[model samples]
Target: MLNLEDLGEEGFLERLATWVKTRNPAVRISIGDDALVLRDGTVVTSDSYEEGVHFSRLYFSPEDIGFKAAAATLSDLAAMGAEPICFLLNLFAPPRCEIDFLKRLYSGMEEVCGRLGVEIAGGDSVASDKLILSCTALGKTTDPLLRSGALAGDLLYLSGFPGLSRVGQQALRRGVEGFEDAKRRHLRPQPRIALGIALRGKVSACMDVSDGISTDAGRLAKASKVKLVVEYERLPRHPELLAFAEQYGGHWDSLALNGGEDYELLFTASHDLPDCIADLPIHRIGRIEEGKGAFLEIGGELRPLLPKGWDHFSK
Candidate 1:
């Protein structure tokens, strides 16, 4: 019997996508990309966060947990170049959990939603053995960005620091002091909603860097049926993350390449793009080429970049 371990996350997703067919003509895009786009300009996406899997109470406050959960789900809407309208939350917690904790969690979500002009439409609550939070975000866009739109000769760009969140996660896990910037990045990720909206007619392809560049870029390349050659030396890094890596004896390059949970935007454009978009700096890291798969250009050599990012069922 084929189990989840053998299929892995991507494998299972591919198999599951095939098994579930979309017959509705209103579904313009589904089972692929960051979110599903409807013909009526409605975009929808959802994400789930479980205790001991996505976050740890040791470092995450109730507010932080709620904020991060909402941000993650909303980031998918941003990836698809949609402006978020509202979100539906589903909370599952044990009866022993305190009401104050739940209130604080909702407060965190409320703060982010208010900033983003999103509303808490409605949700369902259920009793469970562990804490679980799920969010379904809804948005609208006349023209949605897609993963399959990239073409050869397009320039690839990345926003913000890619590995800062991983550094923060490590610092919190190891009980290391300092690295406040990195920790904040992990605890509170800012979804690029404005940037996504700005990129509506400009970007050929775009996605959020949730599963590290090595994996997410590969997905983009596969979807576009092109090769993405990323210049290793050109990748932008934050000073705080570098310091954390050095102090903790971690490989900075590895973290930048494979560390996930950096909810920054990754995109490609055929035309020249501005260095900064609405004060957010964008770095030109690579280019799309006529080939297959993803590669790393480092030290005058090209190497195959595998998907070594987070996978729940990898053994």
Candidate 2:
């Protein structure tokens, strides 16, 4: 049996990359550079996640971790209004990790992949002191939905309600009934894959809400070089948020504006919006403008949409 522990991270990655390069003819490039570009596409993005930083075992299971990793990256693909075809996952875990952990993780990943009809082509693993997941999702779109695609007079739409994860987190902190459902959402977020594919060609610029809404929306608006006028009243809200709002001086709007891990798509349709997007709630939340900067209009009040998302480097 080969002992991967004996090799350092670099050596193991090199050997693994070489193995992949030799076995898979479809692999355009493998590990060894600042980044790896595996296949061809007009749009491509890769995301990395850490254990304690992104999630906690006490709050989420291994299966949940696997599901979250895959789902999150898929959302990025969706944001571009691209249809995801395949994925590559690289895992780093300590030797002491339980064997069942890997199985459950893969099982969760397989569940989401099967639902989305995405392929798990290949991945590389290695021994490490902690768990880290790096997923590379490949997608294709004849007309890619970029953040820069939003034009003036275009309407913005969101696939679903927000604040489930936030309320779930707070509920867990307070011991509530809906906490599990909320935690599950926080753990295994589902990316709007079908809707994204369906919205392709039908919409102008598109992107997913990974960071908080206010934060992510700002990103899309900035990328498009256009101002965003979001009608906060049009935003869909969960009962938990509405309930939590009345008692706790609810920042429900803020949560909806900037809550991370929703994994839903925030897209723009310059023409008429789509007639159908299944299994997910889609609503027109705002519009695009030719100006610069993003703002939110709520109850006849307007405010700047600040970039207040999850920034690992922020102090």
Which one is best on lDDT? 1
Off by over 4 Å in 2: 1-43, 179-181, 247-249, 274-276
State the lDDT of candidate 2 residue by residue for 235-288, as single tens digits. 888877777766668688877776677888788887666435866778898888
Alpha carbon deviation, residue 206, candidate 1 (Å) = 0.4
Best by TM-score: 1
Q: Whole-model Cα lDDT per candidate? A: 0.93, 0.74
With a 3 Å backbone cut-off (N, CA, C), the pairs that clash in candidate 2 are 79-207, 148-224, 212-258, 212-259, 213-257, 213-258, 214-257
Per-residue lDDT, model 2, residue 194, is 73
Can you give the lDDT of residue 187 in candidate 1? 94
TM-score of 2: 0.82
Model 2 vs truth, CA RMSD: 8.5
